[model samples]
Target: MLKPPYYPIIYVRGYAGTQEAVEDTVATPYMGFNLGSTKYRQTSAGKIEPYVFESPLIRLMKDHLYQDAFHDGQILPQGPVSPRSIWIFRYYDVVSKGLGNGERKEIEFHAEKLRQFILHVRSATGQDSNKDFRVYLVAHSMGGLVCRCYLQNKDIPDLEGKPPGDWKKKGVDKLFTYATPHGGIEFRKGFGWLEGLRDFLAINNADNFGKTRMREILSLEKNLPLHSLNNRFPAKRVFCLVGTNSQDYGISRKVVGPKSDGLVQIENAYVKESARAYTFRSHSGAYGIVNSESGYRNLERFLFGDIQVNVSLETLKIKMPGKEKNLSATYDIENNVSIRGLPIPVNKRTKDTFSSSFRSSDTLEEERTHLFTSFLLKTARLNKRRQSLGFSIHFRILPLYHQDKRFLPDRHYEGQAVFDDRLIIEVSKGGDSRFKVRYGWGSNNFKATKNLEFKVDKNNLSTAVIQLNQHRPVNMTAAIRFEVSAWN
Candidate 1:
């Protein structure tokens, strides 16, 4: 039987510029969803290690008993298909020279077609009941924008001459994107000249990435930003997997610049208020974000996990030695979160990789810094003895002093961490149906050694806090706050 939150998933492939590229994309059965990696970075230093990651498509079938929506050499065949199936949007097929016309369509056209495809999948899966039909949209690059265009643009006219606004009724449970340029793609080399040239040519509708075109497609006002979902879609239901490795993205990185996944800047890769993760992966290639182990791990957890955990550093007070007022210091917090059995972290931001940045004193005055949010599958308990899910969080704080806008070399130490620690957390349900959280400092032991007090509100939300202490010259008092609740 199909399960809730394990409903069918629709994979949307990214941009295909030329007719040949569209044909190549259409020829693939799973559209790169079945691609896997044989190696991964073992450390933040870009150390390559041999590790086999069976692609997300195969893993879903083996781990969750999910099937693809293909039968008898045809997709969505005549018979009833499994509700727990995977479907490819195949939006570009219509524009592929081999499949349909050689002409191309705008992103709006692809999105409208996507809506039709979803409805067809719903019918083919025999999920007529509104409550039983739900699908997860997983896209890469431009495909993410297509999904957003469909979900967020309420005024988009359908083929039936009706405007689409009942997205919730269409049963889109959640959306996940890998290395999508949510804020539109921008090149760093040119002072807006290169972007203007690309947009003017409109090659393969490249103008879709331009801010003016983005506003039109997303139905946003001139005052609104390109990344804004316009409050049409729930920000919590979206997850953006950002890639941080720019060196591996080929010669394009020379123009795209650093601090990017190669093509999309890190700052432009995600929507505000949405959950996001950073990994040492590139935009496309062998080191691409879509085919990596970290990508699949985060994807499965966000799609099927029942428990949601939001971790943040709250109530911060930093004290520098022999200085109290007008302290010219920059602080950076590096964090990594990994599941119990995984060899790699699902979310990582380290100082060595240049993914973590220094926080200004003005921001610290607000006293809250979000670390990262992760989801845990309740049924996939790592600690069977305790019937709980387990994960560990590592934190490193680095501070650099400055005087008169000039670096003080004497006060800075290379590769120095002012404060560092790891917290191991195990969460399970108590007898009263409330959540029970157990945690311990990893420096103390490998397992949780203390119970974390949690207060369950009437809405079934539970929250806890852990204080981080022990620093030398810098007396910093910061508490890690966790808010846990049920997720689809």
Candidate 2:
């Protein structure tokens, strides 16, 4: 059995509306987390076959050798089993007549209970020992908020005397949230019939159902990057899988419009400085983001994947009119990444592309800002063992140039420039996963490729920065020199 990074996984389910809703939720076996879909319309372009997803829980059990602990009627494991276990945090069980003790609890209360649950998980799985403990917290919707409250808000005690924010020291190692509204949700109200109804209802109030839907998530922004969670554990370990298909999210989508995942806005589904990826799946339904392949693939990649390649544009040199032509330039930087063997890319960046712009009139102070276009993936696959990352960047320039006084638009002024390269890295199965990175660029255009070798071990990181000119190769070229360490 594979060990180390393969710790027990605890899943926290989202919120339920009323006591009846809570009862309905607890009545299910997997608590909606184990839901699967056999029939569905084609999710891809030029495809007719329906996709079949056998739930995230099943996939985790099948792919990673994880098993549920409950054997008889006991909530905890009765006998010795695999170290790797998956448990549904039945927080709503308290509300159900058969299970949950009494009345429903508040967010803070739920967070405290979750902390206790995690402690229980730690004790049950032999993770109480400092050397062999770490849990991956996977949550959907409001569950993510519960996790955030535990990770960020509460000051729970650890193995040692619980210092302030001691929970940040260890226990929960990483987090992956699905379609969670990290930022507060906002119903579109500028120009619509629903806007009138929303205004009539005054739904944004903190006391209403709006607060229940988004109270914890709405307040997550207060815990910025400098806070205990992000600073202590680092924001890089957290990932937000954003759902973009608001069409299937039901009535909430109609009110929130197409830019949301029905219940939550897509733009608000990410934590600051955390790694995020977007999919066309909805928040939940037949087309739910949690059970979909894209969602599962991304989750598996971020959780199980070893290599993390953070792609960024280090510097840019633009060849523009030297302020004499009365012009201003803005270029949008586009990023796309694809794994060699996968049928579709991990993120929907290529299809529904997202671009960040840079203006020519911007000062040097603006250039000091660090911009990153990033994604994560599991390096190794069964059929295709050796992992390869296909990365590409496109530059779209919008030049507003004036001939006389008014800025004149030119139809022929538009141009497309791109940088494409494929990195092939072979990962070792035994001991530490050894990797070597080699980068190259061509003298000509988009076809430029490189092959410079550098070694990187498990914990050690290797970086390479290459300069691409206005088109491809003309002005700047740097010959980088680096010391090589032993690959073994």
Candidate 3:
């Protein structure tokens, strides 16, 4: 059998509140239940539900721009290439009746519908069952989750039952998702108010309504025993398109934190182990990510990128002590400040007078200085005059006073600094100590500069003497700080 030039693109819509809501607002008349002025309702659970609205894909192709393409007896526009077939599969939400049940049933219904749709396409195209044809799944929001459910569930018998062979190699090319919560959302943090309102309405049990159950089902730990990668199809075939612009609507306004595409947090949109993930100029709002131009372009790339790309974090290096440190290390780029791999306990105490600014005049500075000094003094006293504790400091220096034009208005000075312990020292009876210091310095315009300094002392475990002006120019504006830890 000759392979078709293009694969059919299937679009799936997100959660439509109810059958009535879908028919009335979400989808257009022809694509919705208003076709021929006759409302068609889906029947489930011994009740009649409004016809689930079709996705934008079908609306765009059939009822919108390319409507004539699929019209009966219509001739193709004369061109080098002829048009290929496109199909759409629409599924109803179990809660579309507003009765609130069947989250799992919804997934199963969509999966079965997709299978039937694929069979119908194959029969219509007259393709051999043994030959694999490209299948592109374009799902938005919970629709993506529903597709994942289909892919992860292997017990469903393949309707065609093609001979056991490399179907993937034949052409089962790709799966794409838009603004789908692959990682599951932190609904409480992002949509807390909506959740509260849903609870108030006593409609909290709705399936695919929030991130809670989706999270529970999609988690590696939870799904491992039931449908793990080892037991199910590899997830590397799936591609994710995430949204980063959150200004789409009121729903997008509720999500918390630094980055989001409005409805779904950027973090939740990308699946770590998926084949590929891309971010687009869309929000998590109902019509934003699904209908935007950027969304379509990214969807094309994800479906067609030569090689799939998976994102992950790499460990750079372990920062160690023994260098000429800076005084104002706050601006230093070398300052190894990561909450993930650090051992120091952060001071969480809130002092009424203390603020985050490190300026010498800030009320919090005095309290911080006092706290550090008192902590050191108590440690010295407890050691019985022995070198029981030690610290290494780092900082930066800038010519703030000499170069008025170069100084930053918002920043305290024009330099950066950082410090770490280079040597390990044990408490001695005489309270003497030896430690190495590493320092980094950088001007507002220049890249950072670094150097190492050594300090040796007797009976003074609290402070270290750094050799300055030895390795490079010491344009005084540099400040230094240190931390002391026992040898591990």
Q: Could you say which candidate leads in TM-score?
A: 1
Which candidate number maximizes lDDT? 1
RMSD per prediction, one decimal? 3.1, 5.9, 21.7
Candidate 1's displacement at residue 14, Å, is 0.7
Question: Candidate 3 lDDT, tens digit per residue, 75-105?
Answer: 2112222124444454653333433343425
Between candidates 1 and 3, the TM-score winner? 1
Task: Show where candidate 3 strays beyond 4 Å.
Answer: 1-5, 24-83, 93-105, 128-130, 161-172, 188-205, 209-212, 215-231, 255-258, 275-280, 284-287, 305-488
- The sequence of per-residue lDDT tens digits that candidate 2 reaches over residues 307-330 is 565554444554554444544444
Better of 2 and 3 by lDDT: 2
Task: Give me the overall lDDT of model 3.
Answer: 0.40
Candidate 3: deviation at residue 173, Å? 2.8
lDDT of each: 0.83, 0.59, 0.40
Which candidate, 2 or 3, has the higher TM-score?
Answer: 2
TM-score of each: 0.92, 0.75, 0.49
After superposition, candidate 2 runs with Cα above 4 Å error? 18-20, 38-47, 75-79, 127-131, 159-164, 167-170, 189-232, 317-332, 350-379, 382-435, 439-449, 453-459, 470-488
| Candidate 1: pairs in clash | none
lDDT of 1 by residue, 34-149 (tens): 89988744755678767788898999998888987887998545448888888888888789778888888988888888888877877788765555567899999999999999
